[model samples]
Target: MDLPDPQFSEFVTAFLKDRGLPVEDLQFHSLPSDGSKRLFWRLSPQSDTSFVAMENTPTDDFSKRENVAYLMIGRHLFQKDLPVPEIHHFDLANGWFILDDFGDASLQESALPKERRISLYESAIEILFRIQTEGVEGFNTEWCCQTERYDQYVMQRYEANYFRDAFLHKYLGLKKDWPELENPFNHLAATASRADNQFFLHRDFQSRNIMVSAGKIGILDWQGGRLGPLAYDLASLLIDPYTGLSSSERDEIYQHYLRFLNKYDPRQVEPFRKYFPYLAVQRNLQILGAFSFLSKMRGKTFFEDYISPALKSLRHLLEDLKDPQLSPLKEAVHS
Candidate 1:
């Protein structure tokens, strides 16, 4: 793979040389691309220490803001004693980061066909609770690149419309009368918004972003973190089609999460349960929408592989919920 620009090279050289690693002995390896537009590389040397460098040449406004978010939110989480990666050094103006290399054992690390990786997710749940309960202290909404809270407006515009416009209309080429979808979309948004939205939320807290580094869970891709529902992130984890967790397995993990939550905040358990299905369905819609948009619009075909599974999971949850108001959404899904 190609190396970064000269400025990044200069930064890396100085960053390593200051730590006693020679510039001549370094090896650069390109990491696989994910949903993010940022380029990442693993810089290794003869010594035991290796660093993951992120290179983001922002051409637009959002990417620039995202870099700022990554810097600020990362520092906030680290200061709050959360399980996020240690950002050693960064230059958001130029978009470069020197970060600790959390070696490639994700929570989704190749589970068996019948059952998903239970232990990995269970461990992640513990870290997740901390991210919610403890991470909210002194959290500034300004640190969020996107919207500061996961509310009805966010649901309608981002998740619901994203599903209809990107997945159904554009990707599937369905001539959907979106006005007909208004009722079910409103129902979902209204119901989900009733949950407590004061907690710290990692908006994309899926298996891929949850790393297992040195036998401890470390979170990544936190630029999208904000104040949101407690159940929303958990919903994202449970309905993650990438893991291919069976319905039974989802229930088991969910119950475990509830028990864990009860130990800390018993009052939240019932409310969390009440809004979970809506959030799960909402998250699945976002997934299908995101996968479709990323694959069809952005040409990132890796997302296309998960589209079918996500759609299947979305439909299953819609069926289970069986909300009379969601019939229109059910129609859209079936169509």
Candidate 2:
């Protein structure tokens, strides 16, 4: 057990005391491998005997919003008899708190044969089905209204000399029209605005954020829960860069989600499948740009391993689109 920030642990002890959880000698455990944000653990010899600690970044960061959204959705889901970690205690002032240790079971840790991936994912989808079917409060239009709101800015940022002139043109010796790429972006954004089926979207809802233990799937890292098109979560799951499922497995899960949707709201089928692939295309590009930008500017070069797969997925998806505007950009990327 290690306390990277002593103040946080001190606060944890006091916070647990206030919550009426047993607290004598709280021992902090070091998980050591938190990506994107720093997280730690402190186990108090309390009633539950364990708690996970997380540090909050600035409010502007999407992670912070996700934290808020997770609690909101967790409350709703818990009330509806869903399997979710209980929030032991939280500190809104300094943005540090303790939570239930759902155990050391991750989807990554349990590697069954590829044939079983679909069954596992479908089980996870059932959680989504529960939330979407049962009306959850605290997540509304405001959560999704700003989803593509960052598209134009992201497109413009990459449109500038930042991406093309700096890396693609200079390093990779690739040259192309920056403005032309924006055409698909514009089309996608327009389509996104008109296609509004809002649900409580777990933005990073994938295997990494999902924990499997005690014969149940526990969702974590849901701080970015927002009211977005259900397609967002669906794409994030089916098209996840990690735990990459084969084409057949992905299709299996897709059909499973479709059946779940049909049972709950059959009207979503035509729109879901149609827009899902498009959303996958759009998401892959943004993820590519984001990984590139992070490596290039933010000194997070560890994302290098992710670029090739993202681009490959982008190419695969864009090739499937018949849109003339998208075809050229796809060619430019692959060429």
Candidate 3:
């Protein structure tokens, strides 16, 4: 992809100069884009300091709001002692900011031994607990990029319909009458919507968004967080396709999360477990939809590589869940 404009480079240099950082030998390198519209760069100088510059095009009001939220939420999380990068400077008018360079030690990029994987996940789960409890105290709903709550409308319209339109119809070209799957889709959404929404949720809590450095886990890309079901993030973490965590490993992590929950609120463990599978189905389907949309429509083929793993996760979760109401949806996915 093309690098950011030369003006952006000059802007970064000026931003650094204002911060009293040496700018004589500053170098800028573009970072690979994820599925978002944001552009990232790594800025390094003669000193032993580096920062990541994120630039967002304020194309519309939604984009502007999202950029603002990134700064607002990053500061909030940092103040709450969460493991988010510290924001050094931000320009809301131009939609760019400087952040601490956490380096590229994301959990998704790490090759973990079995025992090490378990320990790291334990740490990650502990962070999740704190983010849910402590991070919710002063969080503002207006800072949320999307809906304030992951309610039934979001589950049904944004996730389920996204799967139908993007994955089933657009990517696979499946023209069959899929009316039979509607009941199961609605049932799954309804079930997930009833989950506890009293905690902060990291909507995309997968391995790729988790940075691991010096045996510490730092969370990233949390501008989309909102008040939602506690089980949603847990399901996202455990059933993540990128990590390729085995079923046994997932079971162990699930149990570990329950134990963690029990230490604080014992009453929530049973219901959380009961609702996890349903959320897994919903989450996995949403991943497939995103992969399809990104690959086919947006011309980002890298996302397509994860589709098979996502499908494997979806089928496995469906098989493990013997709910009769989900049979049609299961068959639809299996086909």
The number of the candidate with the highest lDDT is 1
- Which stretch of 10 consecutive residues in model 1 shows the poorest summed lDDT? 110-119
CA lDDT for candidate 2: 0.64
RMSD of each: 1.5, 4.0, 1.4
Query: Which 10 consecutive positions of candidate 2 have the poorest summed lDDT?
Result: 143-152
Q: What does candidate 1's lDDT look like per residue over 17-128, in tens digits?
A: 8888878956678987588778999988656778899988777888898998899999999998888878998887889999988888777774443444777677888899
Query: Model 2 — TM-score against the truth?
Result: 0.81
State the displacement of the C-alpha of residue 97, model 1, in Å, after optimal TM-score superposition: 0.7
After superposing candidate 2, which stretches have Cα over 4 Å from the reference?
16-25, 32-35, 42-48, 57-70, 135-177, 296-302
Say what the RMSD of model 3 is. Answer: 1.4
Q: Encode model 2's per-residue lDDT on 55-97: one tens digit a residue.
A: 6644665655555655555666666676677776676555665
Candidate 3 residue lDDT tens string, 84-159: 9999888888898889888888787763666688888888999998998888899898898888988888888878
| Clash total of candidate 3 | 0
Candidate 2's error at 321, in angstroms?
A: 2.2
The TM-score, computed over Cα atoms with residue i paired to residue i, of candidate 3 is 0.96
Candidate 3 at 217: error in angstroms? 0.7
How much lDDT does candidate 3 score?
0.86
- Clash pairs (backbone) in predicted model 1: none
